[model samples]
Target chain A: EPLGLGRPATPEEVAVWDIDIRPDGLGLPEGSGDVATGDGIYTEKCSACHGVFGEGAGRWPVLAGGQGSLTDARPVKTVGSYWPYLSTVFDYVHRAMPFGDAQSLTDDEVYAITAYLLYLNDEVDDDFVLSSENFAEARLPNEDGFKPDDRMEVEFPAFSEEPCMTDCKPEVEITMRAAVLDVTPEETAAKEAAEKAEAETPEPAAEEAASEATTEEAPATEEAPATEEAAAPEEAPAEAPVEVAEAPAADPAMIKAGSKVFRKCKSCHQIGAKAKNRVGPVLNGIVDGPAGAVDGFRYSKAMEAAAEEGLVWSHDELSAFLADPKGYMKGTKMSFRGVRKEEDIEALIAYLRDASE
Target chain B: QDDPAIAIKPWMQELGDGVDVSPYGMPSPYEEDVKRRTVEWLTADPVSSINFTPIHALDGTITPNGICFERHHSGVAKVDPAEHRLMINGLVDRELVFTMEDLMRFPRENHVYFLECAANSGMEWRGSQLNGVQFTHGMIHNVQYTGIPLRLLLEEAGVQAEGKWLLAEGADAAGMSRSIPMEKALDDCLVAFKMNGEALRPEQGYPVRLVVPGWEGNMWVKWLRRLEVGDQPWHHREETSKYTDLLDDGTARRFTWEMDAKSVVTSPSPQAPITHGPGPTVLTGLAWSGRGTIPRVDVTIDGGITWHEARMSGPSTPKALHRFYYDFEWDGSPLLVQSRAHDSTGYVQPTKDQLREMRGLNSIYHNNGIQTWAVDADGKAENVEIS
Candidate 1:
């Protein structure tokens, strides 16, 4: 007996959108997945940004480790160390995983990924199988680390007390200043890198000469020193950072076709000289470079791990990556849907090679 | 008598542009700088980020819809009103869906409330970090919303007796959702469609949004598409993983909903420096509380050496921004300036030390501590912490 304004929703429609799973395992679907299966799915879908071991790349979420570091300064809150419930892991992965391509995973895929994450966190054995029936059995280590908000009982009484007025303190001295620390979020790492690059090459005349040479010949020599200087701080000591490969003579038709296809990436990415990082990292010299190699540009955890695990952007690798970024690199920050046509991919690669040179 | 220069001015002699010049009105060219600005590195990208309201340049309580601070989890969704449908499901007796036209049939109410993000001054939990009031306390806006009372909608749907929690879900790309206790939903919640006498802005959830007055901004799910009644709270990603307050003891506090009383001196701050030579200075600020109305606000110019009650102005409505002003003759001396707000619940804005002592330093949300600004003799201001 309600206001008859709209029709009753069909069960099928509700089932499609009613996707949230709860802590008590209320909405879990009938599906099963094991650690081995999860590992394969995770490697194909998630490892590009989350890493092989669930160690987050760049500023994406860290999913493993940090078991007992909550009380320490700069605690790493991850799935193993911080998440209060295992259901949250399954629910989050099912609902919002792969960053941009959310809700695209099958229930079995979600279960497998969740199990793999559990294995990465060391909560599950390698042979452990996770299903709707046994999902409740997997409990998070930090299950007891949360409490209902106690602000009213613990904080309100003390904070509500009448404050002192008139000569509250004898003499006030400036204890700290924001300008001194200068840790404002507006002060970006890219700006610092640019400044450092400028400081290192103080001779303005040399910079002008290099720019002229780059424009005339698009020489690797002109760009190498600049990118190398910026990469010095982030590069590991043991491994030598790979330099961009010299481009072969450009195919004019292929480059033209690639330039047309590059429009899809131009919204989030920039290229050529004077291109700065935008929503996505600058694509200059990215064709043959290692994954997650851009200086001052934060990459997803999976991308960082892939780079750490020796992921070089060769032609076949780039083709596969561009074909299905999420499917190939899981958890990557890149949101672009793959170029469907094979020709578009080849043309894009050719354009990038020519443009980088 | 008119001055000779003004009488012979070009604008005075010639006709100005007609209405045909602009199909839609815009802010004057001189007011171009008065805009929402974001701290670029605050988030991964602009799409899933927040922008600060230009509180430094604004006066009065009502914030214009154009310049209100925007927070988006998956960017602004362009939802067509014709295609939008609000569904009420779960524990309700009848699962109902309403079109925009069907929703307009219900009796509506107009209420002015200040929607503040829980992390408005979250950065200043350690100390005075952001140099400007806009950056420190700009994640808030007071707007007159026109909508139907949530209680009416829930009653129309006929909520089952067992339902204690309602999960409000948005239609945006993130599908932002939050669990609300039935008590709060019945009290002051609104399924709003219009703001400031016009259809909601696309950035502000154009078709419809849930307006949980006085609660955190995230709870006001934009492009609100569904409400699911349940027996218990849904510890979703936003609730458990993101919004929860982590403490130093390795424990976190969850569902800490209500925002405490807070205030800040807007003018004569870093961005809105005192350009004129020091004479009669009017120190004005905004104070609000989620619990109730701000009954009083105390201003301290000598770093709490002396406190004076500022004069409260306009309607002192519950859960709305209350403007206060303190006029005084300036002595042209360097001084530490601060404002402390006290709500009707007898809650005074605590100092940074007191808040840190209670909740610890790890929390990234709910830092409603008293803000301090140091003004130099040159009429310039800087963010500083006093000992």
Candidate 2:
């Protein structure tokens, strides 16, 4: 079959990707799931992100105990203090897990959630059961704690010699400092809600490419969510756009409230007609269009100097930049914090003109 | 200052936009802060998270396939390379699948390498928390891939001498999988489907992936759907629960897969700080090595007292990414910097107390230490750890 270039793969295409399991039990499938039927199918599909005792629920993945915390100081590593293979806990809960519902379980619900994650890490006994003929009597307490990789016999002979070039260190000291434990990522709450919509009125913010040298200024006692995004619009649906100019851009309840304000602009804009550009642009005809038109969208330099001072988006400049996109774009990298109910910016420009028709 | 190129601005009195204005072109909204960022509380979202790779705003050693670093798990699967396929199957001998025009009829090749991320600089193995070189050594990138040679598709579906592991599997939604062996999938694995020469992006795995050259970017995998083969090694959840390693008397390491000789610096770093001050700077960085090329690096602007040798620049290839530089002249004091690398098998890189006196502070996957920064004489910087 040398260079035969792809063809055979039958047996129902190798039983749909031969699932994968290894560690001495070699793909153990036939069935049998216990530990009280994996605590009732892990409380109906992994207790909303693995918690009802696999005690994890927040940043997911914890699947029980950290037994003798592998040199603790915050070492949790889980799957009963760092898995060495219960066939990678029933092949990662039968391939990929319950997070966004992957491979939907069931090889006896991944052997009853790997026998209830080995009875929540006490290595079994919630009335065991597990099958594939006693999967070689389970095994995992760090199955001889691995070994393999020796970093070329302990770190390539202490970092292979010939290094020192002049005095080679006698005093330098620092110890540590990410801004003295300041933990990087700041973007100052979207630059203090675009500096409170530039003090509420002479607007233009949508993060006008954030920089008044913003090296962190976020704690103005975190002004209660930028004072409710500069006083949350106080009801002025401004005469509901005169009954939305006689409704009918397929007004399915204003395109279902512009498809629920397009889940906050589909996490960085994208519209219909197979909308492309993300992190903003691709409105498919960016409402009342013109300014920095979207062909391969790379706008902002104050939106290409307001599209070279011509601009457009009319309808009252697209309802004053959807009621305050950084007070109306004074340098928009658009971190969105606008459209505060001017009737959901007239139902998101009537769902972006009924999704660009 | 007033001559600014004798002011003929507006891009020489404008008329731009029309080379079919973007049939597919991007970057240059002033390189929008050269993206690929993340650390939104590290991970619990953005679909099995991981982002990093601005590499303090890139330069030289490839990377830019729109700022490299991604590491999905269940996200960017977009697929549809004409409904992708691949397959292969356990202990093969005759079980294939292919498509994507049967792997564009084999015989391709290319190479370049450097995938990294056996947790690249894993949060400085418990010390100097992330401060940029795009979060302490942005996961890692280096590109130029192309494809085929997984020993010409395991010699076109015929392996079996008790296989000896392979696994792979990806088609996303966290179907990640890993295993690998079989003599590193017949040495230098590939299957790629282009990279630095386009085709393959939907978050870097559009039509295919799985490179593994010098191993470990979670064994390359990407949207790569299935491979199988076997006779051991699966222990999946990315190799016995997350790329093993763990050392310091609790034991772990397991298939550690190369990637050692590190380096970093990237412009007075901490988001390229020294915005040109204190005379003739230059500096730069990157170096690499999954066990090859990076012939040498060593910088140090006065932290380890005085070292130098840098200037490596572009293509040194073997398991890719090299770049280097050094220039220097700055006298504005307060420096520190660092670098290190080496590797054309002479290894040398270590430090962070020689990897915490041999793997201890909870071996959060490989680390590659020797980083440092400090800078400050107003040329900013920070992320320290010196010794």
Candidate 3:
């Protein structure tokens, strides 16, 4: 047996336990109570806290109509739908009800109220008697819902099982495939060979063609699709000169430092290979990138509308957004308070700009 | 410090900077050494597996409000003390209502007792594999409590002749509840309101709790809110499903409440490895019982080959910590050291083999067998079980 003697109880301890209600309902006393009595009692005393019909007022528990809804998204639970035994209704209502003014009800009142609850749950008809004699017969709808787990029977044996010893499964081979890489062994080798061949053959002509196309085109317009005429007259500016060579490749130390700063953004954002959307958008190659670019991920309507407004992610815009996320994009779900440290902000922006390429 | 007039810091400032209300308070910074000694990386889930108090780091008969260890089947309830209420109805002649304040009107008493979890020494049932005294003897705590005797309030409202049990419930969102036999209630049970010399800490049932000293800690509900007197036990989940231990024969030992006689050597054990060489060694720890005061503690060297009575120190109060020390000269030879306690009822702590044979090695909690610390020639100790 678990240890200790049945020690003598003190007056206070005895008093606390003195409140317990019994199975046989022996402590049940004189006075008659019924569903009708409970309905009026509930409306005046309970409906303010518990909703009318016991669906729950707010954070308070719903007391009715949760019958068979335990698995629903918003389970309509109440004393009727969830409680497994009627004894609980008597015990709980008798002990704790009317929120703060507990232990105030007479035995008849508690009995009548319990009958009313049974009526509400559709378990007992209004004509049913909830007295001590018939109370034990009142089983809850969720009675079978709970049972001692059989896990101990199965689990204890496994836990006590002799673990793997010498020469265990020597013939085992790696049969499981990586889910994310999107490659089979043969396909990976073929792709690598093709990439090597393609890399050796420079795509300078294609690169020049694309640059020429860029020079001829204007930036995307406010309209969802830019008109052909919008791209006509910007060719000369694009051809002007490749002056101010791409900002010097960021320092490795600076990138490392910036990565540390990136931790600050991590609670709300994700980056790197295989990054998925968190509270905020993934930042894969986001520098100088098109706005609202990640495919299939939902962006706030504000950001999508920003994209329609021809708002590409320029260096200045990225800096402004980083400085104040909520201010830059109203209605964004990001709850992050803005970064206060300038040095951290600078380092982060530098890291993002370099990593984006 | 003697001037009871110590400057009281604002409640908000007294806590950590940027005062975070942790739903439950934590141990003070001065008690950093006292914490639930946890096994790092032992289990994948922290929400499930947890440890207990560092009994070795604590002093005084009472476990301080914060350092009292906790165990949760689900999780700790984040209850607001102000919003708490306790109701008493059911089998009573008249349903009695009492707020936390209403409970204060009744008489109160101060007691020194130990509240131990049934799973206190559970992990060491198989062998003395843990290397820390904190790990082996850290699950239990002894304390001086102040509360109202339960019998008074029960009598105030008056219990009917048919009332045989009382169902105590908590105001927690979990609505934790338990059933106590009326006999136990009228015995030495207390509705405690204070611990040590101050108001109860929120973690240790701030406003009110049922203090059935020497009983399993779980039954002493925290943030207690309701009490329903009845004719029979409720067979609540805590009583029927979890707290009840199933024996090898499939029958369960139900409603096992009293913590049996147990003892442990806190220092110079594995965690407190021998820093001093071949000189004097002080082996110290705590011993207690739910039945009565611990009267004696015997130390065994060379694997119980011989026994020596250790000197008992501190208050040997009933149901409270009885610190004992065995001091001896070491010759730098490898030694198998162990300690055994004898309670007032003359029940002696049993050996590992005896306990294992009786309870088997299947339980994850409550194996209070004598612990052995193996001292090597180098004067360092490691936890080892003797065959």
Candidate 4:
């Protein structure tokens, strides 16, 4: 007899959570949707992050294209080119999709999205409908590409040998240097630049003030002003105090609403005292500041040109920019679709003003 | 000036803050920098993102619970242990469910194992891409776990003869799930409830998690809610779309579960570069294997020109991290340092070129290649690749 510890899980309880679809077409819900339906759903639900036509937005996973690119120098391993099974597409979309919102799509929507993704990859026609019955028939182009683990047979034999000792190579030459490549984080670069600047020039008064300002201000604000002047052969310490004093006042409710709206931007931009630069520049004091003025942050050419044109991030300018970042500044590197709601933008501006300061 | 040794220091002269000050103790404020960090650009959102353990800043085998590397498909589930239930059904003679209290009744065992994400060193596949060890090889942690063997629980339910696979699912929003072979489920798999002698941290599945020792971290479903006995593999999104390793020829490799033998020199690496002028230095590292135990580890100083067997110390348990060290007098000359781990299965860690030759550069997971660190004359170490 069993210990009878827990009661039996009800069928309905199991059905709701048993959402996995296997490679052999098991666990798929009964539903049908065509590529046309999927196209609309993908645009409405996915395109904000996963670009139109499955090309991917920013660092989001690409859902289609890149057929036969697995062997390329920079292989784009999208669904059609890399994934081995069609069921995987259905499974992934059903389980985790739309970035933050997961498992929100219906069975028909998942089916349609899967069908549309196939069409985007050129694996199916626009009229092709995908359902539980015909799901396995729509095989991926790389269906036979996958095999079971064979590292023991293929890799272990060679690597298992005792590694060499003494004279493995004749003369080791430094082919590539990390410093020359300069892929290290901005903080390391700034620290090295500051050290070099201190070593070269013994300007105690200015450098002392810069260092003091760094410890006093937000850490993210430390790098740009101190190292920018330090890297260059000039002592421009006057701007540091002014930028530090640029904190803006805001109402609590507006800032609160803006914080909620800022969730959309949180994926790329980080703000606050401990915020470090991520995919986007730290949104510390962008409000009422010069365009593209965040220190050590590489801005798009369009933004640099806008800054050259004497554009400042005034409330109106920020509202315009937040409304349409790319539309306002053509060639802007920001991949986000601007905030559609006016209230959200206003709240975001208030939040950026209050929170960053 | 008077000697500080003779002069009474503030701590010696006065009583310190009482133990009740913290109630629950924390690491000293001075050790604030010892934290898990993430490369922000790696994933779409922080909820589904992974953070790296600060292996460079840590010593010894067990990683502190606070600083353990966290990987969440749907963020950490705040599971109330009292409300949590572990249900065992599907292909079972008698389906059973266990509350947290009921689960505690099962005889538990304590074991130490290293949970490594298959994608731990996946970033460095192209060529010494990430400069820091934290980014390159920090998606792993070793912790002592207290749990009931999954086989014991399965036996309690009495799995039917046809049952060949067990689907482990989480209570997270993503409902992360994976199919474990029946043999593995009955072998060493554990339904762990506690880690490092304390309740499992919320990020590490609070109430319960499946600890599939030596397998990829994803298979260890956190906030584990259910176990379904089945006849076939689920081939779910995680197994089919994500965890599967795509090779150069476009073919992908599935069920690449066992984490191969791998090692990395922790100290004198990018983040923990040598600050003191070269003299007597102890080069230490961590090595582990999913297939079995690590028998030995070798440290190379001159880019394989010389290899010294590192002295294995601390717990050398199977599937657990084995700390290794090589004491050497540093002469301040430029050197290319590397470590090679030899596991119990007579398998040695493969080089990047060898891995590329076999699996190709298209893979985003299961990269157990030997890492190289170029130490310049100034004692700064940089990630580098050698032909």
Candidate 5:
């Protein structure tokens, strides 16, 4: 008040972002959703990645059935097994869910999904309906499994005393060697090339390390940045965080022209750092790439047949396909009528070649 | 006898680049390898993944603005500082929203601190999985930040007596949220905007970020947009299911906010081997403690058998990284080196074996265990766990 800073926020303004939910169920919106309703929504929006049974497809989080497994050597932390509060599921889904598409679900849809998640974990029956009034009745398996941090009381005193500088131990032997495990992959030649090119000039924050950025399957939510996806589900960072430091060198005029040609394909296709398999396979390296090369992406039968026939997407092949999608390959999934202008097709091809790198 | 190489150097015959080139400067072309890199398999997608800092090649306490490791839920939110707003609501006398300009009107202070991801060095828990020190200890960065204390903003909103908890939320699509206790929120926490005397890098929350000094980086929410005061902890997804340390006994520790004392040797590690054939080599590393300042760091060439006190270098700031070095003569033999940090709180860094005995192998977050680098006769180093 003394500084005369910051005006009073309107009630409507506060309501827009105050979406946090607490353990005591203080912020549950007035809505209801049944288990059956949640099942459909989950199948449509989540099962592509989370799996139909919540067993988790690929590296996505398992939403159910990890009870009693916390003490295992490799514990599977799931919504049913590890999460402590039901509010977390509700709040996280409402705020960030369905991966690329977030905050699009309604309150009832989020409730329904929460109910179905409870059912999948066997905490609730198939016919159970979750509502604000009865939300308190539902309890998670790990509700009492949590306690406050006790390191200060327990570990500090033992670690505090002056430690011995000499003769602290009798012997030292190698228990584990990273070379023996050989999990860390060797840096590739392409990366060295990319780095060299990037060093010469700055690209417009267009991330290029797709293989390192997205191709590999990985388990996440280890509690920090690679840290906290958890059972709360999706943490799809806004778009791709600007990997501003690294980018392949290319003509600015060409890249700008290439972006215009890209808008036509942007709806179904994704490129660059944020690219993920959606309606269409990511076309990052599609210009000269092999047909149906993207990992974890399902290709059309025709495309698969073409791939089986050793069809690489050379310049000619792409030009032909772009000119007439239906004529070039019957049963092709791409619905675009095709780029009629020859210059536009060439520019588009040029763009794809550079965009993917 | 003069060296022929120096006389025939290209610099003597050719002119170098002029100042007109590269409007915004970048590291020299020779230093291309000195940049952030990510382990692809660490996360499912780049958008929600994390990259490691090149700590092996870096020196000093301050992490360069460009090379700081990034951890994002929904990638980076490219926010325009002029258009961004910070809202303070819930349990406050009057809900308020402050623009970037309005925040500037208030007084600000500058401080240096380190932000270490709770999952820093997490992969090493199972054993030495990553060969490079960049992979093992790169999930942390220390820098100077300028901003207003969070207490100032809370005071402006007039906090209510019952408001025991504060929920910090990000504007990123994931809408990342974390709950902080009132005691910590009002003490030393800053609503920081500038890092290293410049506006924050886009990936590092450009407009503003909550700086929870001495706390886990996750609680220092980035792209910070809202602060909602409440009566109790929210028990959000990040707090309960993610950041919490899961013990082998099936019980987990929630609100483990502070990063325990941790230290790691940077040079003569896997990435930065003893290229000079092991003579007159200097072993250097970084140490820090969330409880307070790291006053001492001990280095051991023969693993834990014997440790000599390392000379602490750089400005020793509380809750910030302290650089330490040990100069010694190497006889070109196999060596196992490790560093132990002693914080102002008198807490000595624990060994991997010691930590495993207390917390078990499953606690991925807050390993803080001593790391060992085994250098062979060839002066090539490898990441290895010593027993």
Candidate 6:
């Protein structure tokens, strides 16, 4: 209003633009097309694609029935199930129906088709006159089903005018629980590993062979420590003398190989410098730390219960979990299928001992 | 005439294995840029609402099958084309059914047409929120459709004299359907089976979709399946709750189908900034009507201060796209560009303010007023309302 503008659009500008329609049924031209008239127009023009009585034909979409079944597995949402208004049917039909010959409908025919569509959806009874005059009073069934989303009200509050800092909240609570491991789909892992393996095999075949041989030796050495511990309990006197004599001579090659196998546990358990708690508890201190005891990470109910019963991540406890993650801790979200190979499990345990210590 | 034709690469060189690779085919390499346009922040949920079809990116006549705009109240139906069946009961003279094979038995015809949503550009009535023309005007598509006429199919069923309305239903889990009048059915309705001389793409109803030329896209139900004839109208939810327009007086408009004549300049608009320099600038746009073929389109460079008749190109099919061009010399001055269209019946496109005045601002559907594009001397276009 502040800036001076030219005069309003002229009558001629308005005359060329007479196709507008109002929802109150105002500006609706004088004419009527009822259910009966619409039926005739429909059978002759629409039934081929839409089907007779608004049930669609073939791969063509059906247009009628299944009302009041919105929550059902298969909602029969035609114009009846989901349409919010009757005027859309009439307006759309009048402008485009019979496919390819749009706007061919006269004002009266559109009204008649509108009336017929209502009759088919069972929204109107017989003798319903859907003319421009009485069009405004008609109400649809799902009128209350829709309401504008008020997310803006809640979302707007989240974005505050004040700058946020550390004191935004005194404490953060962990109400819901989640897993420690990032489980990947078989296909995704296979694809990633396949490409990497293919490239690695072609260029550095000898290096890969050497690593594989070292990996085999590392698992054997890892099991020697576990075997000695188990034998020590069985023969206390004899095992003490044997362990004291052979402990210094334990296989170092197996330990070196086992350390490389720690990558599998890296996502859930951590090791070395800057290794904090993750989905699972930190492995750096797990050799002596109580089971499921990580500073911030929440453990599964099974793991927590195990820790309450005096279970610790000893070599035996760790071996059973490494064999089968989900089986060892039921209800845990860790989806890992487990290490099937015996040697790989040994390698992983040896690697964990070297890293955890 | 500086007309340059790009070399058409054969299918072998372009698509690799061609039709054999896919039981269904795809768009050519030349049309790689044409695709369904979308906005990430437009709606909170992806399944609830999606914007599609770059109507501005397409040229000539047909909207290639791969890029047809799709909007489903429910998700797109994943129906097996083989198990597809159509039943016609209700008040018909005789209850009949047809399979996908049976539908092919009827004689078919081909025609080029455009399907546009009534809500296309409805968001821009108050103010333009979207930047690209694809998002603003992407809810429309033009295709050379192939189908059997509805009249022949009705004759096969032997419609009872009392049968007045035919309710068409889809086999989708949503059971998407709409009520169609008998008169419009016999007049010009076609049970379209193919688009652009190819089988209907799975996204555009696969086997068949009702082709209601010049009508709102909703009535042209995709994945069609059943038909019930009745003597009364069906007040389906789509008709009453969704598509109806509400006026300022709190009363709602009903049964107002048929897209009024409308036109919009596609290229050199905001989404498509004018790249070529000033000399002999070719300004192109599209015009159409549900009423009939678009007769003429007037382009105004100085914001409707003056107008010039644009040259109509290609075949002027009813309810189909008509490309219009206005060649002019540009002096690199700021220009407020707009296009106005007239149908065969002399109906002209209205301005934004005039439409808002008459309809009273509350209506969400059926806004076919003239669209204005403000172009700077730098050739950047912006959607503007002309007072």
Give the best candidate by DockQ.
Answer: 5
Q: Per-residue alpha-carbon lDDT of model 4 for A1-357, expressed as tens digits?
A: 455565666777767666777788778789999977897898899987676767666556667666767676455666788777888788878877765678889999999999988877768765689998898788888777779988788887888787776677776654543333333343556769977987998777865664454333211110011122222223211111123433445566676787788878875677777666644788778888888888876676678888899899999998998899768876565747799999999988877887666
For model 4 the interface RMSD, in Å, equals 7.1
Candidate 3: share of reference interface contacts reproduced: 0.01
> How much is B311 displaced in model 2, in angstroms?
9.9
Off by over 4 Å in 4: A184-357, B1-7
Kindly give the stretch of ten consecutive residues in candidate 6 chain A with the minimal lDDT sum: A176-185
Is model 1 an incorrect, acceptable, medium or high docking prediction? acceptable
Best by lDDT: 5
Regions of candidate 5 where Cα sits further than 4 Å from its true position: A190-357, B1-4
lDDT of 1 by residue, B301-381 (tens): 898889999999888999999999999888889878899999999988998888888878767788888888898998899
lDDT measured at residue B258 in model 2 versus the true structure, 0 to 100: 78
Query: Which of candidates 1 and 6 is the stronger one according to TM-score?
Result: 1
**Candidate 5 colliding pairs:** A223-A227, A224-A227, A236-B74, A237-B73, A237-B74, A237-B75, A238-B74, A241-B76
Task: Give fnat of each prediction, in order.
Answer: 0.55, 0.74, 0.01, 0.48, 0.76, 0.02
Q: Please give the distance, in angstroms, between residue A261's alpha carbon in candidate 5 and its true position after superposition.
A: 42
Model 1: residue B329 alpha-carbon error in angstroms: 1.6
Model 5: lDDT of residue B263: 95
lDDT score for residue B27 of model 2: 76
Query: How good is the docking of model 2, as DockQ?
Result: 0.25
lDDT of 4 by residue, B84-137 (tens): 888887888777778989888888999999999988877666666667888789
lDDT of 5 by residue, A1-357 (tens): 645588999999988888988879888899999987898798899888776667666556767766888897657788999998899999999998988788999999999999999977768766689999899888998899998999989888777788788987888799877775444544678667867887888763434333223222122338322322232233221232223213455445555565687777764577776677644678777876789889976566678889999899999999999999868987565646689988778777766766675
Across residues A190-241, which tens digit of lDDT does each residue of candidate 3 receive?
A: 7689768868987767545544543332121111011122232331112111
State the lDDT at A195 in candidate 5: 71
